[model samples]
Target: AEAYPKVKRNSKFKVLDAADIDFFRSILSSDELVESRSPEELASFNQDWMKKYRGQSNLVLLPNSTEKVSKIMKYCNDNKLAVVPQGGNTDLVGASVPVFDEIILSLKNMNRIRDFDSVSGTFKCDAGVVMRDAHKFLHDHDHIFPLDLPSRNNCHVGGVVSTNAGGLNLLRYGSLHGNVLGLEVVLPNGEIISSINALRKDNTGYDLKQLFIGAEGTIGIITGVSILAAAKPKALNAIFCGIDNFDTVQDLFVKAKGELSEILSAFEFMDRGSIECTIDYLKGLPFPLENHHNFYVLIETSGSNKRHDDEKLSAFLSSALDAKLLSEGVMAKDKADYDRIWTWRKSVPPACNSYGGMYKYDMSLQLKDLYSVSEAVTKRLNEAGLIGDAPKPIVKSVGYGHVGDGNIHLNIAVREFTKEIENLLEPFVYEYIASKKGSISAEHGVGFHKRGHLHYSRSDIEIRFMKDVKRHYDPNGILNPYKYI
Candidate 1:
């Protein structure tokens, strides 16, 4: 770290050179690893899914097995190498991306399903196994994992466990943290903790595996995970309901909790901008109406029987429509229509990205306070001439997300804006989130990008406790350092 100008020796993996890569080649399988120092690949790999925090990486390491990771970690521990363990590389923040072209340990080659206990319905997959693959794996059996999301098509289990990822199903099935029973993690000191106990109640000391979840690879590498699978709902029902007002949708959420508690699996919102972008990017997929709505909700439910589920959803929508809560609503006739309705919501971020640059002010507040915050920020941005610069019919920004969990993916797009405006918007957005006593990072972890603003969500005492935990687990400070602090 002292040798490099800006690099810090925070993690156990070292930034190795071409010669360094040559040194490790003999000890490991030659085909699985690559010593990528090229500017193009490094630049591509250094960025995140959001493309907000692009970084520089020196060498990218690909280890195929837990034993290989163990050996690599041991070697890094001895040589003072700082490592950034990465999976899938689909995180919104720069969690998996290298900070300054330091050595990167890619888990892509480690994809495998190590074991599956049918009796307990527990499945353990390698860190590099993509999420969609896991879904297929479960499909091959007669079971399905309850966790579902837009990213499930690409996200991996390792990254999911590392970030404690929550999705639409989180409202019902709960986060992965509660489902994951055991973990096999390679500690910063190069030791493996393989406790594959699938028992529900283990009064084990400390419940150490919890540390790796949502730690963003700062604590250690989650090589493998054991999680309990859930019974698949036999009857799947998807609904796309259009309401003129966003407030009515919020009201519907409160009422639905009382009325359809068990059937309401996911309650998500799609702003007008999100809808238009989906239409624009995905081609002639209609927005389910003659005109656009202020906010749309894609509500879905899974029940024991399709007839009962469809009847209940239809009855629910009828009540809402009769009450003039929504202009129109449709329950999916089949799986194909169900997937089409979801495309409008699932493809928002990607479509938005194709436009140009974007800045995300993701935060978690009281669901009641979410719209008000968005309104206030939208008003402020308009006042600052951020969007007012354009000609007539300026492109109005949009903000919407998992209303069920109070996590909002608020974003701002300026066709051409100054760095000064960027500076102004950052404080305006984060400060408002702070005033609400909300989380600065709702879904995205505090990995490098949001660490500076952690104080907005956590207190001094809580932060101190977190640092202390990091110290206790990795006293050498050789873990993914300078992150999530």
Candidate 2:
């Protein structure tokens, strides 16, 4: 297991014992309980998808219903045992997995679709339902979930909701905070509080559901979700274009928003370093362009009229080319090509990791200065003699993300995970983000990884209020202890 030297297990939280296991076995079926005796089965539950953060959890409970979850939480709270609420276990930050001997409460068994109102375009489902499954279900009904991401197949709706993941379709559908209507969350003390409703407008007191949307399960475990869905677009088109520089990328984005307007679904940006790393990792995947450029942009449009969308996209591309904003471009010929083009953008993170390790920072900066951070980081690492060919700890610093949202994913791919490399990035990256008056974490929640660095993005008063909220919800700090404020 990887060690988090800065954090120690809270003495207030009790260690798991035979009595707790027996109590859990009585409430849950044999299949739902996974004890550490079968380490093989518990392995995946303890490690994160990135394989960078790991836990030494001794037991895992897979509750099939909210009632079962409530019972387990009540007992754990009374016993002062810490618990980690997990779904899909696909979180990049160290939030989903336990840092120490905390018990794992996996939501995999709660996979169920409660209801869907086609007329209202509202969907209600258990938190454990996979995102891909939800998308497929909505597609059949001529409706679509407002959220879309590269990890749709593996990530659960609950996981995405908990992380408040801003994905590829965020430009079109906005964020989960706006799309999600309500939630059924299990508070740390085992109380199941529900704000689940299909109505779009309800100005009754506080919208408590919003708290759990990106809480990372620190105060509660989300068992069900009620979210707004959009009508499936009748037509969809995607284009991959190469740009000469970041300025051109910004100009093209403005042009896309003005020309494509309502039809524009996504505008993603990738720098030369990102493209080179992807190329090296993919190793001849037949890139979209005949030649490489300093930057790449993937644009997509979705609307009810195919002819109108095509004409708008065509006109936009022509003007962009004439203005020299785009050096080269290619429109996806079909669905297969569309998926292939998206792969080039989505495969960046894992591709960078293929070399060895990746130090990822999901940051939000001013549009004009978005790409500058990548350039500055690359130059800094290169000057430090840490980034280069082989035999060096650092491989390269690459940047790519949803430029329309002003979110940039700065990745420092390295030969291995070393303290020295992290030391070089840490306070430096956070401080830079602070200086820009940007968020240290754009979409990814402040997990165990960024818990201590909240000051970079939040003021002392804001953090104090957050801590107060945590205390009001989980007074014992039993829910996801030693993390998140």
Candidate 3:
């Protein structure tokens, strides 16, 4: 894997010592403290999910309650010790892991469902609650969390809110900015700020809670969340299609929206390269369609009535087929079929890494130019003689992502991670997005991986404003140093 990017440690922060550990132990139980003296014990906490970044932290604190988190923050701030607040450690961009010797403030122990109002669809929970567990709680109450991700089983609710994650269902339920009612956060100096209300319409001053959403924990650590849950659909169906090209994919999407309308929940895109890699990784798994095409699309619908949803989907498929928009297609007729179809879509990322290493870029671009960047990068790699059989640096570059939100995930699988390959992609990818007036990051936050590349997406004034906000809330820069803006 590629080496962790080099960044100078901030001189203002203090190194961990016995006194610090003793102070933490005073407020927390023995189970809550993990003295990272053993490399094996801290391996998972220090390294990121992608195995691309690593840190050498000496201490990890797990607080079960907001009050305990407040106490730990107060002590760390008083001693000028930098801290990295971690949750689940499932962040693809290295946002949840420490960059250096910064102490890790993990919230894994805080996984608790605080309250739920079935009538109003308002659910409250501790920030460390696993998303899948929260979703199960809501599901039993005939409601569902507004967000859905493949990593739901492992990702923490607080991490999703902090990153402002946009997942498969974003096309339907909307973003956390619109669904989250309130957040309870702990400020840098250990002050508790609670706005965890269940009000749907509160025209309050400034909507201050929004600042922490998508802030990536640079300003404060989110401890509790109150969000408006959506009612679970009684009937759901999915369809996978093979399209002739990107143009037909767009046409099919517009048609699906017009025909499927209210019941449509997700629209995902996968290029041929992505499909091929996924199939290769699956090892002898049959393709969904009779023949392979240049591109594929997955469309899902959810509704209250099974008959109505089935009719709508059937009619939409008939119309699309009549228009010659799809080369071939398969619709889920049973729950097993639905699950199998989603597996095909979700398996694309892991498949990209089958080659050994993968460089992933999540971006937001206009639908018209969504796949162009991937094509260009592939061409660039080919021109540099990096793509080929054995001994070649790159195996393939694939493109796929959520079509509803104008997001695209470009993955380049290589024999191994190398500086030359990274250098070839960095500014080129960022500049391409900037030229298209697109965001360098669509859903992923500008964590340590993308921190230096913020200028490619944000104007100087906007970056200055972000830095100003960071300094205003965390003057000591002790919270999540060397991350975000």
Candidate 4:
């Protein structure tokens, strides 16, 4: 990876020395404290999943309990030592790693399933627990976590809360703000705030837990989470539809809502470029449709009866074909068929990166104008002479995302990360989103990469209020500094 511009470290923060190491060594076990400078142990922690962002932190601390985290935070606060709270480190926007030499505080060792109430379907667990494990635990009890992501096996429950992640299941279960009941956070000043309530409805003074839901660990470290779980559907089905143009894609979505009604769980859209990339990445996997189409949609239905749900989905697909809303379609018949259909959708992220590098933009737009941004970007790149298959700095442009929620994932697959391509995309893309009154970032938060670009989505007054809140909670600015407020 090319070296990114360096951010200056805060001079007020004290440099780590032997004395600081000794203090950490006293409170933590030998295995818990990873202070070695060896690249082997620190390599994974230093680089993000995309390998686009890299940090040079010399020390990494793993605390097994909340008490240890509190103590370490207190010491760092008193000494003015900066800290970065990391969980899973699967964040795409570079929020979980250090910018310079800040200490790495990892929550991997604190994973524990604290409690689960089968009657009310409430779950309480440590923040470091993997999302897959939580979902599996709920599945055994006939319940399901409200959230599901492609990175579920690696992403932590707490980390998802910190970013307010909205995954494929979001169209059905809604966002985490509604599912998350309470949180246990350790403030930057070493103060612990525990509001782990599992009640369905509670009209309290102020909803304090909402602050840390998407704060990205700037104000505090989320230690635990209490969330409401939904009952698992008895039957599930999925279908892949191919359409001739974007207009048909929109019409299909509108018709499915009315026809499928309550059984519809997910509606996803993918362009031809995205499917081409997937085919290249996942070789030998059969494409759903035989004929080439401009657009494709993956619709999933979940209900209590398999026979009834299948009949409804079949009728919906048949109607769509009769109306010419779909050119070709295939309904999954078994678990093997279902996985094969979804493999096309879930494999998009890695396929985007199969090229040398990828610049990803996740945005929320109006349903009618969802694909306009991607089209405009492709035109701009071609005009700038930065797009091609060989020798050129660019590879191709693609767009795919959860069309049900109007979130578009626009990816610019490139030969390498170059300043020319970035300069053409930054404010240009941000301005386009702002003009349409859409959020610059949908699921991915404004981490280090999008810090300077927040103005495109937020007003100056709003940013000021956010900064004031940060100062109130983290007076020293020692918690995830040099990032967004």
lDDT of 4: 0.90
Query: What TM-score does each of the candidates earn?
Result: 0.93, 0.98, 0.98, 0.98
lDDT of 2 by residue, 1-485 (tens): 35788887788889899999999999999989989876576889999887788888999999999999999999998999999999988887889998888999999999999999998888999999999999999999999999888788888999999999999989999999999988999998899999887488999888888989899999899999999999999989899999988998998998899889999999999988888999888887999899889899999999999988888888888888899999999988888998899999988988888887788899999999898888888888888899888899888899999998999999998888888778888888888999999998899878988878999999999999889999999998888877776
Per-residue lDDT tens digits for candidate 1, residues 202-265, read 8858888887889998878889888887766787777787778777988888877777779888
Instruction: Report the lDDT tens digits of candidate 4 across residue range 288-404.
Output: 789877888999999899999999999998988899899999999898999899889999998988888799899999998899999999999999988887889888899999988
Instruction: Tell me the number of clashing residue pairs for each predicted model.
Output: 12, 0, 0, 0
Candidates' lDDT values, in order? 0.76, 0.90, 0.90, 0.90
lDDT of 4 at 317: 89
What TM-score would candidate 4 get against the native?
0.98
User: What tens digits encode model 3's per-residue C-alpha lDDT throughout 116-184?
Assistant: 998999999999999999999999999999999878888999999999999999999999999999999
Which window of 10 residues has the lowest lDDT sum in candidate 2? 1-10
Q: Quick one: how many clashes does candidate 2 have?
A: 0
List RMSD in Å for every model shown: 3.2, 1.1, 1.1, 1.1
- lDDT winner between 2 and 3, please give it: 3
Off-target runs (Cα >4 Å) in candidate 1 are 1-19, 388-396, 414-418
